[model samples]
Target: MIEQTLLKCEEMIQRGSSSFYKAFAGLPSPRREAVHVIYAFCRMIDDSVDEPEESPYSIFELRSHFQNLDHAEGHFIWPALRWLFENFPQSSKDQFMLQMQGQVRDLSFTHYETMDQLESYCYLVAGTVGEMLLPVLRDDSNEEAQSAGIALGMGMQIVNIIRDVGEDLTRGRRYLPLEVMEKHGYTQQELERNVVNDRFIAVLQELKGAALDWFKEGLDNVHTYPPESGMAVELAAAFYAGILDDVAASGYDVFRRRAYVSDEAKLLMFRRTAARYPSPFGGKGAAAVH
Candidate 1:
């Protein structure tokens, strides 16, 4: 029964983490399974918050699942995540933080009043995933590795916020920090208009700069990975960083259209990434460790 539960959980995670899973193909089987389990947990949390209909029910379901996982002994995903928590002495799993996000989602509290607030929100929903992943992938936990993972996670999340600005606004959600918008003299009305205004464009430019900085920070930390463990991280980071380039090419008109990298561009990125680091794991990939 536990095996069946884990398999079902794996299926759910694989579907939710299609973006992450593609990169995991480069991982060895054992490491790949850990990544899958991590993503499954993230998927469960995201579904609780993002599902448009029956989201209330989804939150309850996730809470129930976690309760069962904590008290019982047979669930596959539970034990896998539990093993990761137990094995990584330097790590901490803030289940309370995870539960808090479900509450935030339930309230549809997506808008932000300041960068600090946005940062806090990012840490909960995305950075926590990074913390979970680092312990699973790295042989030894390093503060540098954890910091880089958090930055990468935050950068990816900001990219998602930028991409979804329009849709989110339509859904009565706004993720752009109010401080950034007001600082630039932009308005929620302007966002709702979804026009290519100079003020709006400038706001996006500032946000993009911030995202790029985080990406560079994440890139710097990637070297801490012992080559093999770093492959998936490199792939996902490069993939998400490509979205920033997409936004740039669109002239920062994120309000008018959501920028997306083409499949060709992804293939080109994959090819370039593969050429630069032949082995997904360690070995020569470490030579680039500058």
Candidate 2:
């Protein structure tokens, strides 16, 4: 029954984000199912905050719902999440709390004054996801691998911020640090207007540079995971990094269009990453996995 529920969660993830599903494809079943459950939980929380009209519960009610997980009766997500917490109690609770805290911030905190503040927000929203998934990928005792996972999560969040500038502004949020914007002579007013000028481009370039540095630092230890898990992380990072490349290819005109990696490009990335890592479940690197 739990397996069936987890399969439903897997379908949710596949429908919501094909890129993430692509990354998860390389994992063996055990880790893959764990990841699906985690993703489903995160998706539930994110939707509760981001789309209140569609959500069954309000943010406060969502918190209450999760807090009462032991008594949760009808929902598939609660049972799936309960199973995860029962099996991996070490970090899942704290990580979920942190993720919720970040969502709360999203409700009230729309602007950032410094990079430090922005990074803290990123860690809460994305880093905790890394923390949650680390145990499933490998032993929970490996501190270094856990740290790398957090860093990689942060890098991915930063990439999201960089890519979604226009969309974020439309929603009345400015994720870029106010200081960085001022330093580049890009004002909030200009950003809200979706102005694509040289200064705005420079600001984006700086943000992208910072994101790439985090990606490099975070993914430096991809070999830490068992072959397939490592390849999954590496491939996901490569896909996110490819978005950076797309942004550049668009000449940093983020205000003009959303940037994305093509499915063909992702397949190529999978092949290259698989070649570099040499998967244990391999026929021909990622070709067989996909």
lDDT of 2 by residue, 161-196 (tens): 999888887777899999999999998888877888
Clashing pairs in 1: 227-281, 227-282, 228-281, 228-282
Model 1: residues >4 Å from true position, as ranges? 1-14, 52-57, 72-91, 99-108, 251-257, 278-290
lDDT scores of the candidates, listed in order: 0.69, 0.83
Q: In the order shown, what is each candidate's alpha-carbon RMSD?
A: 4.5, 1.7
Q: Per-residue lDDT for 1-290 in model 1, tens only?
A: 53455466558656665556555556654566667767776665665666737443466665666666566343455676665455554545574356446346636576789999887777777777777777667778777878898888888888888877887777688888999999989988878888667888788878777887888888796766755666667778777877778877887767668676665676566566656564543344333221
Looking at model 1, residue 86 earns an lDDT score of 57
